[model samples]
Target chain A: MWDYTDKVKELYTNPKNVGKIDDADVVAEVGSIVCGDALKLYLKIDDNDIITDAKFETFGCGSAIASSSALTEMIVGKNVKEVEKITNQDIVKYLGGLPEEKMHCSVMGHEALEKALKQLKGEKVEDHVDEEGEIICHCFGVTDDLIRRVIRENNLKTVEDITNYTKAGGACGSCIPKLEDILEEEAAKPASDKKKEETKKPLTNIRRMQLVEETITNVIRPILQEDRGDIELVDIDGKNVYVALRGSCSNCMVSNVTLKNLVEAKLREYVENDIVVHEIK
Target chain B: MERVVYLDNNATTMVAPEVVDAMLPYLSGKYGNPSSIHSFGGDVGADIAQAREKIARFVGADHDYEIVITGSGTESDNLAILGSIAYYKDKRHIITSRVEHPAVISLCKKLERDGYRITYVPVDAKGNLDLAYLKESVDDDTAIVSIMYANNETGVIFPVEEIGEFLKEKGIPFHVDAVQAAGKIPIDVNKINCRLLTISGHKFHAPKGIGALYVRRGTRLRPVLYGGHQEKGRRPGTENVAGIIGMAKAAELAMEHLANIDEMKRLRDKLEEGLLSAFKNASLNGDKEKRVPNTSNIGFEFIEGEAILLYLDAKGIAASSGSACSSGSLEPSHVLRAMGVPFTSAHGSIRFSLSRYTTEEEIDYTLKTMPEIVNRLLTISPYWDNEKQEGKPINL
Candidate 1:
């Protein structure tokens, strides 16, 4: 189960505008039986291209259902042109906020509304396709450039955090390794820049360990400690130092990078030359 | 600790004091391997035989000697399905349902790679097996028909008895994974006439790491795991003495309490009704009539199941979801999918499985807390904007 917000739960428990209108002017549906979610949007369009009434029937999670209901509610008296402009982000922001994984559910609502609007206008809406120029995750239809931009902008440290920004690994989850590759590629640039700053002066191995321990105790421990986690320096050998992580960090998948980038980079910044931090298994 | 409100009975139940007392002597003073040729071993073997007879009597099996003890429910399922398929190597066809537990489903998938043809039967919207389809699919070449007695997700009981009779008439071997239904419902292998049945000890309040498979007399089942001749050459391994004794005692207790099962059913119904009445647009999954007495799958239209479970956990309540596993995968349950449930509502489904131990107070507390939680989550939902659009007053 995705950790839904209070708003998502409300719409799920007592969804509004369910069922269908018999005399609906335009009806639109999206998704398929295999996707595990489907939505049917019914609209009552007036002579002036205004939506007099709107209702929806959704077959999806709370987020999808709520998003559809929210989309219909948002567009019920608005013009067809206005409904076409409503994006998934607008639906999510309207719902207070949705969990990152469920952001796709909101996208479904936006698509359903747009399709309904196109039907009402008697216009041919192009099928949703990843045009040649679009940088999609390929595995899940998320764009690679969008994911990269999110990582660079948010200073995202983990792949899970990148999911919150771009929803790259939420569907099918085949794009996860690719997402990691992007995170690593983006994370390497800053690391090398910091290493360049430390290369100006070289110190001894003992001084490096002391400096790394200080940074961890001051900077890293406080943040991880909030999650009932901690980092410890195990052994310092030549330029390689081993650290044993405890609490939540021990079971966390991304701790390896935390040891490498955050711990090692900070050590290299203030301490000796070519210090490598290794995680104790 | 007031028994700690053991809602995790679905995982395992507390050992009955009587069952513990019955096994004390064998665990300590009478400790001996049942396989030895000495007096000490003979005494332990007698105790084992007595426990097996007690288990056989509870399930109404034809022969007590046919019951073979194994390491767990997974082991029992593996031994029954894989062992049977291997024994009948000439027959390559096997039939099973899509909603079966992983124990049966994964094994069937593995067997499919080994030159076996498998037909995965689909279920109705209420999780009931289509017996008409089953009859049409079964042929002379079909080696086995494996279906679960009841689904662990929705507690929807299958028509195993009917399937058993149909398969028996055709001389095709039938196997029922009765891990969830055993002790909770009445199972008569004689009436069902199934060639094999699997039951997990932990499911019925016995200790974990022990289960049994009922192989009818003269059934050809090759051993999957080979080492010792403990279970009449059918399953080779040392007996789990304590677990088997505990299982026997749990079965005896289940039989004694069979008449009072309606109490649990009533509590489950009360919880379901309360939730439905308190929240609008809420609906139940699976066939209401064919479901187990103590389980209910409810879909709250706009909330995610994980959010509800987390809130419930904070309030000291425990429940499960069929939509996604704990690993955070977004795949809706295969059981719900086979039933043709739409994905929109599938992710919002929460399963509340009750046991005989559930109390009216617990139900009352749940009823009171649920509506409030639902309202809180819905207040900020973009879905609720529909109410505002219709000029309806927002409650929150």
Candidate 2:
């Protein structure tokens, strides 16, 4: 579960403006059911273009709901121009903090507020549209050139890593093939001597298995045996491993904890840090 | 250390103490390959036979020889579906419902790629399968009709026995993935007339990485994995002796405690009633009358399921969302989508699956804490704001 701040929880439980204002000067609806979150905002404006009253309805998770709720509370007494200037960062700050993944929830609220202001002024919301002739992955709005740049800079090993860096294919997932094409295109390019300075060392499966077995027998098993437990290496797949518990350790209640902390930690320290150890039954 | 309340038994269960005791010897001093010709091996084989008998008795199968142990419930599912398709290569059609676990769904996708035809039957708003569609989908070319006995997400019980009986008359093989329902509900493979059934050890109080499939004596299947001549070569690999022992012991315990299932059903209903009465716009997902004894899916309007889950977690209560697996990913649950649950309520659906371990105090605490959280999230929802606007026409 994501850790929610007190402020986020408070706003979630007792959201400031939660009803529709009749005869509002501005209204905005953003997101769709497919996106798994939607926000609708209503604004009551005074003669001076001040947002006298603001209310919101959101269909989303706690962060989305709380962020929308908080957004309404922040903008009700502010002028329309000021509301337009509210950023996602500001909304997140107002809620004390939001998990990084949920940052999009705040961005959605900010976008809805801006769209509503545009609707009030009889103007179009034109921020997301691009006129640069630079093709963005239409599915997720990640530019083709940006994907190339990320691949070139990060020296990324897989398409999934590129997703983490650029948020490409993170939404809609239709951009995955295009992203893969870019990765293959980059891999085909010639590399300078300096860029390929280090020689790749491929460890044999037998050697890898030996190292895992030794680590468990020499390090992990002894430590666990102190608690009347022991671990045996079961299977090794690259850096990932499967270990079986023996003796008293096999049926210990805290076996998962031991596997995660002791066995996995020791193997990662001695070998690669990306090892995922599963406890064998 | 702080006390942790484990209400997430539906996800997986803690092994029972007696089951653990039964498994201890195999993991330590009694360790011996069941296939070895030595005296130790004979002893191990005898224990495996005992476990097979216990599991067979638990599910009310006619013979202990019908059980074929495998790696996990997923492996059991794979073996049943894939193995059956392999045996009857002439019959290419497979029928199943939309709310199956990924184990079944992903395997079906793989089979589809391998040129097998698959028809996914739909479900009602309450997550109940359409039996008429199931009957319609099956024909002479249909090799197997695979459906879950009970849904893992909504806990809605499917009419497996009726479907099994229907297909038996037509001479088509019926396979039921009874992983979630095996221990919770009484299952008689002979009565259901199902040629194949799948069960996972971890769903009950058995350890993970061990499960069994009940293949009716005459059913033909090809081995998916090959090495040793274990499980009568139906599932050829070294046996998971300790896990099988634990599973048998767990099944025995489940059978012993079967009479008290009503107590769990009462607790689950009480939890559902409290949540529905306390929270506005709250309703249960799936048919209330046709669900498992210890599961309830409830939707709290205008609140995201993740937030509710986080709140419940913070309060030391463990529950899950129908959308939890797909929470980070934007896909609203396929189960909810298939059931035609409205998107608004589907996103807010929380699954509170109870176990025999769930207590009255825990239910009371959950009921008390839930309404406040729902009201809090709803207040800020833009959907709520939009509903209000729709209620009263706004004049510019």
Candidate 3:
């Protein structure tokens, strides 16, 4: 129905690694019985912190199942630190792309990866958060912080978009009114923030370009530097900011998405929403 | 695996050679407007008359003029219900089943927005219609009672003849969407005693874009389309001459092969029996005995259906899934959901429909290949705990 890419169809029909790892060092499961799709991830990490193997068990639609399988394939031989950088869009990119409604399936893959890493790091996982300021979407295990952040980052305007992205109100829909309130609050946020950023903008073109370079240095450089990758600001033409992806980042499968979503998104949040980032080969 | 085992016949059937032979003349040398004054065009009109007569005979309509040709099964359904409502002015209520095809169901929804009250009768767990509820829901204001003769998903045949008689007694018009039932089983419109009945050519063996609606003689109805007088001022448009000719040939073939349909039933039963016995936690959907001859809707627990369908597709075993993942909308089939099937099972239902072209060898291939795919998906499924799994899920 989604017009699934050949890769998604292939992996779903013949998944690479399935079932649980008997001696899996880090096991993390996300998604609840209330939610339609559920996924459990198992990671076998070696002494040097490289993931020796990974496997997954999923109960969901074609995209959910395929995303889980792709996630398993993605992190199998990578370091735990590098695995932590795997985003929802990375899984989506690995499978060509999922339908917008099925984007939550890719989000599940990202969360499963995070939960497993938290386990490996001896960090506490929220098994059941009944405390106040926690568990806003009880139908799903969606925390208030996650919902607020997704709302802010994606500039999500409605409860339906939130559901499509994070699967917050996709279940019983009891939390829909609550989600609407949160959405209202989040919607009012970026306008004031944008106004504040606009007030601080330099009038001169040279100063504006300098500010763009400084924003890239302060915000996007550190992220790419971690992956033995870096970015250099090439030029700024009006709203378009051109940058060359240096090192392993250029060869990375999902670097284009990272450039648009991660780099450009951060630039827009920090600088201006009108900024359109382009990779200089 | 190189060979295909097509089992999605309720979706569409392969055109017969004879039907194609009849259509070739209309497509090439005999292209003439039936309404033209030319003798060549008049001969085409004569051919259409003969074709109409054959289709009328096939459906047991009393008069050939009662058969009005339309663009498709969907158009025929739209034309019948909409036409009946147009002619019957002041009536504002409609009744249909929960599992009617989207052609009818969506139209009813649109009508509801324009101040029409529509009652959707539910079905039992086995996909059997609730006749008592249907009879009780009918009223003097009811415009038309549009119901499907057989379900496209589960192949459950409704009691159209009984319902038709009951509606006739109430002096209310009835429209039957027999697109799925027409060729697979007998359709006697006179015996049905309905105001209208619709059947598509492609469902039997003709090419797509051709269908006929049976308007009982003197059952006043309006046309959805407006143009030249092709179907006796009922469906006014230049005729799809080639398609109508093919449908006539196909109808003749369908009548000839009507008894041989039991062969499809035997293959379907073998396929259903083999799968049900071979796999644990596998079961059937709809009424086991009341279904059309060549359909088997099977539900396998713990795995989603689109994955299964894709796996089967990769293996060249054509089938259809009722899961939300298979549909454009992210909701499980309305038919399965209306039947009160559990979320676990409903999300995993697959419809394997056969035709006269099906073979035991194809069934054997399907029976052999399906369990392997099911077993693989089940192992990958989180709900299907291997530890709880018994000796072997698949008998083979």
- Candidate 2 DockQ vs. native: 0.27
B147-247 per-residue lDDT for model 3 (tens digits): 99999999999999899999999999999999999789998987888989999999999999999999999897988888877788899979999999999
User: Model 2 off-target regions past 4 Å?
Assistant: A1-29, A32-34, A40-58, A65-103, A116-281, B324-326, B385-396
lDDT of 1 by residue, A61-177 (tens): 557667877887888888777777776666875676676556557766766776776666688654432122354554345556556654653346777776644445766677788
DockQ-sorted candidate list, best first: 3, 2, 1
In order, candidate lDDTs are: 0.74, 0.78, 0.85
TM-scores across all candidates? 0.70, 0.72, 0.86
Scanning candidate 2 chain B in windows of ten residues, the lowest lDDT window is B387-396
In terms of lDDT, the poorest run of 10 residues in model 3 chain A is: A125-134
Q: After superposing candidate 3, which stretches have Cα over 4 Å from the reference?
A: A32-36, A45-50, A77-81, A117-185, A202-271, A275-281, B388-396
Chain A: TM-score in each model: 0.50, 0.51, 0.71
- Displacement of residue B297 (Cα, Å) in model 1 is 1.3
Highest DockQ: give the candidate number: 3
User: For all the predictions, what are the DockQ values?
Assistant: 0.11, 0.27, 0.36
What docking grade applies to model 2? acceptable
Q: Write the residue-wise lDDT of candidate 3 on A39-131 in tens digits.
A: 889989999999999999987777888999999999988888888777787788778767667778888888788877887889887664311
**lDDT, candidate 2, A196-274, per-residue tens:** 4225354567876777788878888788787677777777878789889988778654455457657887886665545
